[model samples]
Target: MSSENLDVSSELKSDSSFADRTKSVSIAEKTSVIAVEATSTGVEGRSHAAETSTDPLAQPNDELNKCVVVVNKESGTVCDLWDDHFEAELLERLKANGWEPGLKLVKGEEIEETVVAAKSRKIGGLIAGGGDGTTNSIARLMLGSDIPMGILPFGTLNLAARDLGSPLEPLDAVASLYPGRTREIDALELGDRLCLCMAILGVYPELLNKSEEFHGRNWWRKFTKLGSDFFKAFLSSPKMELSLGMDGTKAERVKSRMLIVVPGHFQDDFGIIPKRESLEGGKCTLLVSKHSSAWSLFRMIGNFLLGRSAQDPDLEVKSAATLSINALRRKKVLLAIDGELAKFKVPLKLDLKKRALLVLDPKASEE
Candidate 1:
């Protein structure tokens, strides 16, 4: 089988969670508003703005009385994560927890526009559903805004959700976030973009993600094509020389096959992606690799995944509040940002932004 593009949960437990609930109309169609069931397509919540105030954005100042649920239908695991009536059930859950709820099932391209429109409704909280990439997009969109966000892990890995102590199960996740409770968190800024987790620059992304499309037939063909690409990327100058500077210090030269940067350090040498120490630590850790070849790097990663860490000289971990990296020969480098692939310009700069986001945290309220 072609392995998953990123680490994901092996078993996606399908839990049964449902009850009667109320729904709101989309904030976009305020002129011709009509009552619709909570689960109706493109539906939103009971607009307190519509009934009480002339301005549509008449939201409460302190309490999160209303929430808009935005689900990216194209996310990898969304199709199997919930039932057809999930929208209704989710709205009901929010209602039971004292929230005015709205629902929008949108394709990937419509996510930003759909969300921005809802935010104009002055929603108290924005509950975003998708994988790490989708969550990353929403978090970036909400940055510097007063709106807090809640995450539903419906994509592969769901690393961001894991960091937030959210349940991998969809309903359990929603149930966890009490209506008004939220936690402030931080992020790492990459140029103009935001990274909630980590950014990796290395040969693996170049090798695996370079394929524009894997056509032909059968799983073996796909795996064979992948192996071929891996070897080619490996053989084509597997190592790159990089100049790194931390906290505006002078640059130092280093050779690496893979370089990993995290908003904070990853503690415990276990799991596919280990848990972070804290999200608001205001420090970044750079895991630089000196593994000689593709095979060696693979072994090192495998060791990490399998929960074994020997203090080998091949790996170095450095910490900084701000970092600069320049590849010696390459103008742009293939990168994995929160498990999504992109090509970043040379001289990548990274820094920490503390208390940048307020995410719904049921655990915090429960505590």
Candidate 2:
């Protein structure tokens, strides 16, 4: 049998084991644990303590409204402005709601430290402001924890927040915080690292590297720079040889130009994109692009705009519960998870941590 055929057989066998693991947790136990964690973490019912106390504006109400607002002060455009005014306005809004907002500036290598502080203080919810990178960092911190998360979109292509209908305006989102809604969102775990949106390799990762330079530049300049980078990459994009393992099975090698592993649907101008059908069933979506000409790249983009990229002949799409990627040679490639760029390494493994994140999305009904 061909390697592709063997991979299909292996994938089917893994699905049964995945289902058994999910069925072991009871609904009641899940609910009780989440509630207990929320209350203990400082998010439950202390909205008005600061006002009643003798001290004036005592520590800006850290007790009742436990929040760690993570912002990337270095990101370009409105993110800097957003971070500048975040604390004062956030505290005001939380205070109005009878809660205190804890503000923490995530500076030089302090992401893990801030998360630890929030957990130690038993804060209620985590608010991630800035772009996708900042959001992913905060989400990774709260993974497997019952503490709910809120988004304050301030980055280019606030894809995750756009899906939740929360725009970049801090006070506007804060105003809608009362009677908050929650949704169980999917997460992808690659080795020790957790990704809340997607794990991307190839051309997209390279584009992210270019995008970082345009940060803080004018909007028009940023757009122009991006277009130039895209054209350059499109012209010289090299094919990659990779081996993939699904759900702990043996590996299958394939040659491709790009690979995108997604846990949920990412939004664009093409309307509400649907994620992989088995997303909630403990699986991830893998898209591998075959070697193609410039014209083929244009067609793929056009098809994606028309909401038909999956049907394009040059792309291969599949669903898997767990995936591992290995490069044939040790080449320096770029990798991105939720728009954050990093150096690529060989033997990248992704595991499905199904429905592990509690995201606040008042717009969507609970599943």
lDDT of 1 at 288: 87
Candidate 2 positional error at 228, Å = 3.7
How do the residues 188-306 of candidate 2 rate in per-residue lDDT, one tens digit apiece? 87645567667778876767555554443244565566667876785687788889998877899988878888885443346423223333556677888884787888887777767
TM-score attained by model 1: 0.76
| Predicted candidate 1 versus true structure: per-residue lDDT over 315-340, tens digit per residue | 88898988888899877777778767
Reference-based TM-score of each model:
0.76, 0.72
10 residues in a row with least lDDT, candidate 2: 7-16
User: Candidate 2, which segments miss by more than 4 Å at Cα?
Assistant: 1-66, 76-87, 96-98, 106-108, 210-212, 216-224, 266-281, 331-333, 362-367
Candidate 1 least-lDDT 10 residues: 13-22
How many backbone collisions does model 1 have? 2
Error of 2 at 243 (Å): 1.0
| CA lDDT, every model vs. true structure | 0.68, 0.58
Listed per model in order, the count of residue pairs whose N, CA or C atoms clash below 3 Å is 2, 8
- Report the Cα lDDT for residue 172, model 2: 73
